[model samples]
Target: MALCEIVNKIAACGLDCSRCADYENGEIKKLSRRLQGLLKGYERLALIKAKTNPAFEGFKDFQELLNIFAGASCGGCSSQNVKCPIDCHAKTCHKEKKVDFCFQCDEYPCERQFEGKMRERWMERNNRMREIGVERYYEEQSKMPRY
Candidate 1:
């Protein structure tokens, strides 16, 4: 695909879908599967450990993490399955305003639902998108390290 096309995969929330761990690839799914297998294998051991140790209580946290990994796959907001509040709001707002991005709206910096550092990050990203344009923004995002 063309660079611009790839960049256009960025979500309305300013997240580069292309940089998402779950975007197009099955890394998260594979990891989740492996973790599930390991957890299954260690279930008995975990049960024993939990009986004598408080730290093993963290097994619940591990299961939560596993759930996150398992649900990490996404195809961006355009996907029919996407149901994020930010994505839905952005899409609706942009469509109503006939603009391509949130930055184009007069309420660009207005508080919709975001708060604190999250709002700051969103503003910064939207400003950067405006400053650099979508294509270049994606290129810059591509150069940044991924989690």
Candidate 2:
């Protein structure tokens, strides 16, 4: 099949879909390891640098980094951005009100929680929206076919 055709068939998270491990799972592990090493070294450096570097000043408490890393790495909204009904609902609702993901709406589904496969995607995008914002959500989501 052609590239576009293949890509179209391949599932994606639309918003944070690029965050998935996918074929990059191995790379994620390697990069995680490297980041851990650099972070460890940075931690050691941060101790001394915090007295000088403004950047380190904010991160003076190494416990904060450890606390942040204690949780899971965000994957993506593969279903929220790709699944059938959820994708349809998101697009239709957005177009109806002329906004991006539910985040922009005054009446967002704040009740959403990690439940079904589709919920999993929302969990990721809900978090990603904080980083990328609603415009990117609509932009990426719009590229997707309605069906």
**TM-score winner:** 1
Please give the lDDT score for candidate 2.
Answer: 0.46
* Candidate 1 structure quality by residue, lDDT tens digits, 86-107: 5346645655666656787887
User: Model 1 Cα displacement at 82 (Å)?
Assistant: 2.1
Candidate 2 residue pairs that clash = 13-78
* Cα RMSD, each candidate: 4.1, 12.2
Query: Could you tell me the lDDT of residue 1 within candidate 1?
Result: 43
Cα lDDT of all candidates, in order?
A: 0.67, 0.46
Off-target runs (Cα >4 Å) in candidate 1 are 1-8, 17-30, 72-74, 85-88, 96-100, 104-119, 142-147
Query: How would you encode candidate 2's per-residue C-alpha lDDT over 34-142 as one tens digit per residue?
Result: 6666676566677688777777766645445544434324332322333232333553455556554455566555443336776676656655564675445545654
TM-score of each model, in listed order: 0.62, 0.32
Candidate 2: segments with Cα more than 4 A from true spot: 1-16, 20-32, 60-147
